[model samples]
Target: MDAQLIAFTGVSAGLVAMPGADFTVVVRNALVSRRAGIACALGIGAGLLVHVALAVVGITAVLAAVPALFRALQVVGGVYVLYLGVQTLRQPHSPVGNPQGGPTARPLRQGFVTNALNPKVSVTFVSVLPQFVPAGAPALPRTLLLALIMVAVALVWFQVVALLVDRLGRWLRRPRVARGVTAVTGAALTVFGSALLAGPLRALLRAL
Candidate 1:
């Protein structure tokens, strides 16, 4: 990749890695166990792997080629983000959000899946990975390398978010604070949805 593209990807990844729901999930796991935190980090990285892999194989290209498929995905993604916004408005339980898996191998698995299945993530992976890759780069290894870079960026930033928040999680969980937190999170989700909805406007701008 060119230097500009690399820089763009770095900045974009940094923006995405900013303190948000992904950070919260990793922080939750870390407060539970350091190992779990690392595992969860890897899992979140793995979810990006899926996105990068799909981009390498031209999956999003096919989707983008078909207007219907692409628009349908955008609609679905927008609706899902709206749903997440609503869900975030609910009261968060204590650290043990779910006790059913209390004795499982590690909480990393579910945490990872939560991110992996997240519609916003799917939309992002399909959207952003292809941009930095350029048109003529070697497919597999280059894509994998970019994926690793994205993951590395995510791991460093988010693990720090986890570590820093661990010190504050107790205080942040207070009833009023948590509600405020959730409300802000909901607004962020709405912004993501709006961004996805506005994506088509990019095509019009390019056409002009």
Candidate 2:
């Protein structure tokens, strides 16, 4: 059990460290404000909890089993991410130190929506958790434990990222740098969304 736990933790850490939509969102918000960044991390943690619950309850399994439903979810998720990228690109510059810049909760919501809508997360939960569960152990308790560990790893990692980015707040807050960062992150997200949309379509076309 200990060995399994260690291996799972290592895998989870690696997954958390990989730069993806979550990383981009956290960094983007962190550049805006520490509060916003932390809020986004919390939202992402909340989103992980939702995925864990769904996976444990077998809802993710159902989604995986039904190809059409999963594909539909991917399409919606892709469109939503694309919209976010466009919104980020369109965002106007705010004066540095303006407390009224925007509601802090906005980033929190963005984090949640961005994570929850991601089909890749659902796939991760569905595919990865089962590998570490002991053959004869009570599946429910073990699964939840592993899922919670993954969530903890993700939350801790993102919090560190947010804080580290916030430490660079002085330079990043400069209008030109901020805009440049925004453009890069926004473009990355747009590309990610495009890939997500294209993957399923490409597979379908090949199948036909």
Candidate 3:
């Protein structure tokens, strides 16, 4: 059990650290304000909990079983991310400001929706959690424990990112650099959305 827990933690750490929509969103919010970044992280943690619950209840498996529904979800999620990227790219960049450390509901909601809508996230939880469930053990408690560990690790990593980016708040305040950061993140988001769409888009085209 200990070995499985350690292995799950290590694998989850690697997954959490990978550059993705979550990382890009955090960096973007962090550059805006430390509070915003932290809010985004908390929201993502909340979203992770949702995924974990769904996986534990076997809802994720049901979603996966319905191919059309799953594909539709992927398409919607992909298009939404792509839209965000395009909007970010088009928006005029501004200096990082001292946004009042309160009223950060938007960023929080943004983080939650982004993670929650992602079919891949659902798939990952469904696939990964089963691998570590110990033989002869009650699956429910073990799965929940693993999920909690993943969320804990993710929260720590995201908070670190938020703090680090906030520390560089000054440099990011520069108009040019700030714009550059936005552009890079925007491109990254676009790429992520495109990757999600590739197979589905290809299939759709063939069916046309």
TM-score top scorer: 3
| Model 2: lDDT of residue 162 | 88
Cα RMSD of predicted structure 1: 6.0
TM-score of each: 0.61, 0.91, 0.93
| lDDT: worst 10-residue window of model 3 | 92-101
Each model's lDDT: 0.59, 0.85, 0.85
Candidate 3 colliding pairs: none
Q: lDDT by residue for model 2 over 62-93, one digit each (tens)?
A: 98898878887888888878887877778736
Decoy 2 TM-score against native:
0.91
Winner by lDDT between candidate 3 and candidate 2:
2
Q: What is the lDDT of residue 150 in candidate 1?
A: 70
Q: How many residue pairs clash in each candidate?
A: 0, 0, 0
Give one digit per residue, the lDDT tens place, for model 3 in 8-67.
999999999999988888887887789999999888888888889888899999988987
lDDT (10s digit) by residue, model 1, range 1-208: 6794578577667666665555655655554445565566767767666666666676756765686566556666555555555555453433423212233344456445545544455456556655666668765766566666776788677666656654565665566765566566567766655665576557556768
Runs with alpha carbons beyond 4 Å of true place in candidate 3: 99-102
How large is the C-alpha RMSD of every model relative to the true structure? 6.0, 2.1, 1.6
How far in Å is the alpha carbon of 83 misplaced in model 3? Answer: 2.0
> Between the candidate structures 1 and 3, which one is better when assessed by lDDT?
3
For residue 182, model 2's alpha carbon misses the true position, in angstroms, by: 1.1
